[model samples]
Target: MPVAIRLADWDTDRDAIRSIREAVFVQEQQVPVDLEWDDQEETSQHFLAYRETTPVATGRLTQGGKIGRMAVQKSSRGCGIGARLLQAICERAKEQNFQQVHLHAQQHAEGFYLQAGFEVEGDVFYEAGIPHIKMVRSLI
Candidate 1:
């Protein structure tokens, strides 16, 4: 399947991106509802990956250079959709002149970001009942 990824607007792509995040983070990973969704959505730049118009992956970059809410559908796991979403957000951050992009990566998914040039920065911490580690990648 040909994958398409693009910057998403909260007004237009909110439902599509929310669906993907809900499935991966809420239903699958058991992330708490309150923690999974936040007010930051309004201010952050989001990216969505689609397979022929069906959203499969998503990520968001905030004004403070924080990348978060990265999720990929179970069916789309192992494909490059997650990477594509990450790259889209990273490129956007770079274009916006961010010096570094950082994220609290789920411990299991840390390797995925590591492969994309993100380095683990600190000891593991818990977020939304899941173990996470802070990771950072320089856009400079």
Candidate 2:
């Protein structure tokens, strides 16, 4: 199925965004709720991927050029929805005149971002009990 990607409004799309994140990060991954929700949502540029009418994945690009909170439902993994979401976020960063964009990718998913042109920048560290590494991609 073709996934549709779009810029999401935090006000109207918060529920959909939270559902995906909660399912993946909270329930499945055991990330603390406090660590999952942050003050950045209103200021960040959010992207949502939908398979037909149902949202399957989501991510956000902060005003500071950091991409985070990426989540794709387990049933939807390996279908390329995540890459599509990342591309949309990167394009949005370019539109906002950001020279580069970075993300804290979970260690296991580093290869996914690497294939998308992001470079591993530092040693792996733990966030919310999961290993993560900083990765950056230049857009200029």
Per-residue lDDT of candidate 2, residues 1-140 (tens digit): 98999999999999999999999999999999999999998999888999999999999999899999999999999988999899999998998899999999999999999999999998999999899999999999
- How do the predictions measure up, each by TM-score? 0.97, 0.98
lDDT (C-alpha, whole model) for all candidates: 0.91, 0.95
lDDT (10s digit) by residue, model 1, range 18-46: 89999988999888889888889999998
Q: What TM-score does structure 1 among the candidates reach? A: 0.97
Candidate 1 residue pairs that clash: none
lDDT, residue 139, candidate 2? 99
lDDT of 1: 0.91
In candidate 1, how many Å is residue 52 off?
Answer: 0.9
lDDT of 1 at 104: 95
Candidate 1 wrong stretches, greater than 4 Å = none
Clashes of each: 0, 0
